[model samples]
Target: MAEQVKLFGVWGSPFVRRVEIALKMKGVEYEFIEEDLTNKSPLLLKYNPVHKKIPVLLHNGKPICESVVIIEYIDETWKGTPILPADPYDRAMARFWAKFIDEKCLPALWKACWSKDEEQEKAMEEACELLKTLEAQLKGNKFFGGDNIGLVDIVANFIGFWVEVLLEATGSTDLLTDEKFPMLCKWKHAYVNCPVIKENLPPKEKLLAFFRARQQPTSGPKYE
Candidate 1:
């Protein structure tokens, strides 16, 4: 008998989308359960009691939490298109960038979007520097994983899709313009236009609406 695979996540979440795209890349059949982040489901709580977060992958009744961890688990469990490179050094590099994006790049971008006054300016600077670092990593490759979309590519989904919307909404495209971050911009274009990613992406208008609604004048930035 085959293992039962299930994913609990929100519809427009980049983290969840990464796992979804990986599943599609590997041709893994799984059940998807969308969770209301504000009113998280009992199953989400049950599976990820510590975080009570979505993007939890359940395989054969065992749960894996955290988007990056879940992606690695999916790659290891399914023997289809490989996510991580086989060489140990390359694999380690992939993990490093994935963590860097989640910890450094994402928070920096969030700050650029939500922080006010001097904080926002500082965040924009930090985000630009971080983006430059990421751009250098591409080394003119079609994707972060060289010729193919791999772990780092999935992890950096936000840059490919969400960043443009956020930048446009905030009137901050100057921070990541085609001329400023040419390689990064080119990579993003490639990443999003790839058939697998382009086809499964959430409707742009819906995603724009989701972020626009979140831009409340009073609320602090919340990294979901």
Candidate 2:
């Protein structure tokens, strides 16, 4: 029997995009179910009962929650282009950096984009410092995944694309100026311009409109 695969996600969510990219990279065929986060679908709730979050991959009736875990599942289950490295140590390092991007970089970056005044300043500094740490990781690599996109690159979708969008929508910060982090800026330009990645990304206008509607009063990111 052919594999049954379904991906449940929210539009414009970088986390969801991560899984989508992985699936496409592996040449896996799957159905995409767009979830309404405000009023989530019962299937989404059922599939991900714990966090009730998105980017859940349903494979052969089994649900995989969390983007990173789902991605690892995709890598192991499919036998096409590799997402994680082949060497055990390299794979472990990739997982480490993916964890850092999620647990450290994302929260600070999201907070920096949304928070204001002193709070924004603090968040921005923390985010920049974290980004600088990530920057150092890219000394010789064109991507965190070396020459091609991989786990860390996928995990960092938010920083590479959404940071600029958030900054534009808020019109409140210049946190990621090219001069401040030239290497990252260059990486961002290159990563998003790749044909495969560029085609899969949510339309910038739609994203900007969505985020513009979502601008908050300094309470900060919904989860971060």
Candidate 3:
């Protein structure tokens, strides 16, 4: 019998979506357990003691933490369709871009979304520079790993989705405007229109309402 697979995740989390995309790409069948970050489940804590974060993959009761790590594990375990390149150098390059987007671009975008006034401006500048760097990196490649949608493409695609949400919430479109980063704007179109992504993405208006609700100030700490 095939080993049972389970994924603990939250719908809104990009990291969780990364794992979900990888699983779908690999043609792996698994159970998805929706996690509430505000009130973390005991099962999630038991499975991922360290970070207690979502996107934890469980195979035959063993837990694997982190979205990227889970993606790699999914790729290695299943052979239906390879998400990483066969060549070592190409694989390394894919990992490099994935790491770059995770470490630098994601945080910069978050800062830009949450910061106020001058800080928001500075964050937006940093985000624009990061997008320029990514646009240059994709000069001749259709996806991050060239013609094929690979690991890096899966990881980076979230930027397009979430950044749009942040732009709406923060009332800024400077980072993804056509004038500054045309290539990235085009890439966003491709990423969103991709069949799997188009099907899985959260509804825009609902997401907007969700973010707006989170942005509102709470009255006080209360017992209900």
Candidate 2, 50-108: lDDT as tens digits: 99988899999999999999999999999998999999999999999999998899888
For candidate 1, the TM-score is: 0.94
Better of 1 and 2 by TM-score: 2
Model 1 weakest lDDT span, ten residues long: 215-224
lDDT of each: 0.86, 0.87, 0.79
Off by over 4 Å in 3: 216-224
List TM-score per model, in order.
0.94, 0.95, 0.92
Best by lDDT: 2
Per-model clash counts, in order, read 0, 0, 0
Q: Candidate 1: lDDT of 56?
A: 93
> What does candidate 1's lDDT look like per residue over 1-224, in tens digits?
98799999878888889999999999988999988877888898999999887789999999999899998988998898999999999999999999999889987887687666788789888999999999999997999899999999999998888887876666653577888899998988888999999987888888777777764434423324
Whole-structure CA lDDT of model 2: 0.87
Expressed as tens digits, the lDDT of each residue in 1-224 for candidate 3 is: 87899999877778888888888877778898988878989999999999877779999989999888888888988997788988998888888988998888887877777677897788789988888888898876667757767788788866778778867876765568788877788778888888877766777887777776775323311100
